[model samples]
Every structure is written in structure tokens, then in C-alpha cells.
Target: MSFCSFFGGEVYKDHFKPGVYVCSKCDHQLFTSRSKYEHSSPWPAFTETIREDSVSKHQERPGAFKVQCGKCGNGLGHEFVNDGPARGSSRF
Candidate 1:
């Protein structure tokens, strides 16, 4: 999906089940319901991952980073600094 469409909060707006979210390409577990919480952002936000190695981060540019599946290198989302629950950060 395009970045705007993916982040437009339309994909998982109704997904409230407590389960692990995985990469669609490789089934690599990325985030879990426990770390999820509501935010004003268009996309779903997670405070943490299932594990430290669950996803990989790449510097897209200065002060910007992109998140990808650690196992298959698929783009998952972007990371941003904010007053989120996870030590003042959040991932989308």
C-alpha cells in the first residue's frame, strides 16, 4: 500500500484482538497488542516490539528512520520521537 494509504488509519482500525502482528511477507513477528495504544496519528502505534530484534531501523535521512521487518527486510513503518508510552517514543 502507498505510504499515505497505509498510514491513513484504515488498515487496522478495527483490529483489537490481542495477538502478535507479523510481517505479511515472512511472518516475522513485529509488534504485539500489549504495546498498542490509541493515538491521534493516522496509523496504529506501538510502544515497543515483541523483541529488540523483531524489526530493523534504517536512517532515511537526518532525523528520520524507517522501520522494516528484521527477518525479511520488508518495510513496516516509520519511527518517530514523541511522548509515547515506551520511554517517550513510538513506532507506526
Candidate 2:
């Protein structure tokens, strides 16, 4: 069974929801809709995107964190700040 992710509107209904958003390219479960504090960011505003093992951080754009699929190494998206709750929680 093949499964798509939230990227490009290709997500499987059975696994799509607010819990742990996994990557289609990678079977890594990250982020959730609930973690999204409903703010406006250039990209998807996620309070957190899974634990440390689910993501890979690479240097890009001089000094930036690049999010890549842990399984297939697909470029899912980039993460940003200045939004969500001010609780200063770990985004892992």
C-alpha cells in the first residue's frame, strides 16, 4: 500500500490528522495540526515537528535549518519561528 503525505495535498486520510504528521517520502512521523497555533507564517506554522529522530538538520541558505525526509531524503519544507505559543517549548 502506497501512502502520500500532506505535502502537495497528497495525504492518506487514514493517517492524516492532528497528532504526528509523518512524511510521505519518509515514514517519519512529525508535527501535528494541533501543534499549529493558528498563526500566519510563510510556511506551515508548527509548534513542533516530531522528536529528534524524525528530522535531519542541514545547513542551507548560509545559515538555516533544512528539513529533509529521514527515510527518503526528500525535501519536505523549512521551519521558522516568531509564531505559536510563547511557552518556549522544544520543537522536537
Candidate 3:
């Protein structure tokens, strides 16, 4: 999933309807449509997750974090801090 997202995969890049995005391997709710937004990147970008614990974050390095499914630990993508619409918010 991370590879596909990094390589500009076309899974949910254009999906803007009100719905929930789940993990392919576990069906755990990860993101919601309300948080979805259009971005210049080819992957689907969200301003937030479905819940505070919906995704887990791991510090890959200084100022970099990797995001994964909280329920199944599937590699979803990366999270960028202070780079989203809201102040101090994260982009997933």
C-alpha cells in the first residue's frame, strides 16, 4: 500500500463522496470522507483520521513519521506534521 501510494496509485485519489476508507487486509476503518481533501499529490489525502487511535504513528527519523493501520498494522502511508490545513495538524 505504501509503495502504491508513493508511486501515484489510482485507488482513492478521486473518491470524494461521503464514505469510510478501510484497511485492505483488516477492514478496519482508517479514514473518513469528511476529512478527505483534494491535493496536488496523486494519492488520496486526508486532513485527519476516523479516530484518534485509528492509525498508529512511528517515528522513522527526525521530523518524519510512518503511519500504519492501528488494528492490523498495515503500512498505510506517512504522516506530515504541521503541513496540513489546520495548525499543528497532520496530513495522512
Candidate rank order under TM-score: 3, 1, 2
lDDT (10s digit) by residue, model 3, range 52-76? 8898999997656899989988888
Error (Å) of candidate 2 at residue 33 is 3.4
lDDT per residue as tens, model 2, 8-37 = 663333343555566665566766656655
Candidate 1 regions off by >4 Å?
1-9, 61-63
Model 3 TM: 0.84
Q: Give lDDT: candidate 3, residue 45.
A: 83
Checking candidate 3 for backbone clashes, the offending pairs are: none
In model 2, pairs of residues that clash are 50-92
Best by TM-score: 3
Ranked by lDDT from best down, the candidates are 3, 1, 2
Residue 6's lDDT within candidate 2 is 41
RMSD of every prediction? 3.9, 5.0, 3.0
Model 3 stretches astray by more than 4 angstroms: 1-8
Q: Judged by TM-score relative to the true structure, which candidate is superior, 1 or 3?
A: 3
TM of each candidate vs. truth: 0.76, 0.58, 0.84
What's the true lDDT of residue 36 in model 3? 80
